[model samples]
Target: MTRRDDIIAAAIRLAEQSSTGQANLSVRAVAKEAGIGASTLRHYFPTQSDLHEAIARRYMHVAINDFSIDDSARDPAERLFECCAQLLPSHEHRQIQLDTWLSAHVNGLGPERRAPVRRLLEHSHEVTYDHLDRWLQVLVDEGHLDAAEVAPSSTALFTMLDGLALHSIITPERITVDAARDQLRWLIAKVLEPKS
Candidate 1:
């Protein structure tokens, strides 16, 4: 990796490790973790804000890429469930990212400082919406759902997924992946079932 990449990686690691407490990171500390000198880190990052922005951007990208929609699940419902599973992070990692993100927001160093972070948020949302749209199309094509019901169904499904993600993050012990998948399937079945 290039020096810049090394520095960014070190910053992310530092942020992840120090996210829980009052451990204020320093250039020297990050450089030590990164196996580089403090002057080298300074040459690349220049300021604490710059380092923070880099770490935040890297975190956002990692989160976005963690959800892989490329799996060969021909069934739209299965693909949706897979995507949902990706949304549920390990409890420890989720807490770290959540704490770091909240801290960044409080410190006024969130997406506002970096256009890439802002774009990542927008793109991630768009990707989710697009996946839902495709699922709706599949349902309609299979005669399981009415074509006219696409918009409302997609909106409701996305909202449900978002709610489930928040709940899972807050109560990781209670919200297992299987539970989320089962609930999602039940909701979709209810929305798509034909009138008796």
Candidate 2:
């Protein structure tokens, strides 16, 4: 990878490792992690805010790429449910990203800092909405749902998934992944099941 890519990757790793309760992030630390001199790191990222923005962008890109939509499934409902399930963060890295986002909000890095994060957040929402939209279109086309039902159904599913993700991140003990999955399954069944 190019030096810029290496530096961005290192900054993301550092951000993941260094939570809110940790020491301040430093160019020297990121440079060492990136296997480059601080001067070289500065060449690409002139300020800590620049590096932080790069990290946030990279995190968002990774999250977007993780959304695996399986269109080959015979059942449209199953495919839609699987796609929504993929939006939830894994337990291994969810807290790290959450911590990084929360840190960015309070760090007072100004527009330079907040802009990329805001873009990332918006991109994530758009990606999720796009997936839900497609699912609704498929259901409507298959005659399982009416065209008029698409928008409200898609919004409900998206909101349910977002709420589950938030609850999983904030109250893992109270709402386990299994519970979230079960809730999602029930919602999916309610929304997509035929009017038998």
Candidate 3:
């Protein structure tokens, strides 16, 4: 991997660490984790904002584009559900993501702190919608989704999944992981199953 890729990977690793769960980790801590001198890290990142931006972009790319789903899994609902599930972060990742977002709000640093979180969340949202839209269209083409419900159904499903993700993350006690997954699957069934 290129030096830039190495630095970014190290940044992600540091960000995702339980210790660095919050977004305010010092650049020195990240550099230490990356096994590089702080000066070396600064040579590439120049500032914490630059590092945060790079890490956020990498997170979006991995979370949105790198995951694979089975289109020929014989169960369209399951397939589509898997596709949507890829957008949700793991427990550790979720904690880090939530901390990052929450810290941004708490600091009230305006663009300086919130920029990375805003960019990451917004890009992830758009990418999720695009994926959902395409999957809905494919479901219709495959006779799994009814043509009549294409527009409204896709939007509704996208909103549901997005809301569920946030709710599950912010209030895990209220909506347990299994409960969230079950709800998602149930919603998928409603959209994919033919009406009686």
Candidate 4:
């Protein structure tokens, strides 16, 4: 891997292992984890915002794009639901993600502390939306979804997934994985229904 890739990977590792998760991806911690001087790390990232953005982008890419679920034999609705499920926190990481979200958004931060956190959340949403958009278009190309349904369906699915994810994190007893899966599968089926 390139030095830049190494630095970003280190940042991701530190974030994952941290109490605050992604919100803890500071320049000094990442540099120390990478065993590089802070100056060298800064040379590649230039600023903390750049480093956080790179880390979030790479981490989300790996999390969503590299998910290993085998959907080849599944119907299109099932396949799409599997893809969307990757966005929700897995059992192992659910608590960590919840902690990070609470720390970054629920707990009050001064203006100086809030901007970077806000940027990271916004960038994460953008990356997630782009991936969802591409996944929906793939189904459309395969005759599973109408072209007109892509925009609204994508938005609705994203919003539902967000709420479902939060519920899974904050109240798993109420929104178990099976329940979430059923809701998502139902939504996907509705979106893919043929127009009369």
lDDT of the candidates, in the order given: 0.66, 0.71, 0.71, 0.77
Could you tell me the TM-score of candidate 2? 0.58
Give the Cα error of residue 12 in candidate 1, in Å.
3.2
Superposed by TM-score, candidate 2 places the C-alpha of residue 25 at a distance from the truth, in angstroms, of 6.3
Candidate 2 clashes between residue pairs 3 or more apart in a chain or in different chains: none
* Model 2: per-residue Cα lDDT over 51-128, one tens digit each: 876776566556543233334446766766677776665566667654554554444344556565566566666766
Best by lDDT: 4
Please report the candidate that would top TM-score against the real structure.
Answer: 4
Q: Please give each candidate's TM-score.
A: 0.51, 0.58, 0.63, 0.75
CA deviation > 4 Å runs, candidate 2: 1-3, 10-25, 32-36, 64-68, 71-74, 89-120, 130-154, 165-175, 194-196
Candidate 4 RMSD computed on C-alpha atoms after optimal superposition onto the true structure: 4.0
Candidate 1 lDDT over residue span 1-196, tens digit each: 9898988887777777774665456788888989999888889989876786676556655654323334434555565555545554444476665454444333444444555445545555676666667766666776667888888888887777767666666776776656766777777666666766
Model 4 alpha-carbon drift over 4 Å, by segment: 1-3, 13-36, 46-50, 66-73, 107-113, 169-172
How should the candidates be ordered by TM-score, best one leading?
4, 3, 2, 1
Better of 1 and 2 by TM-score: 2
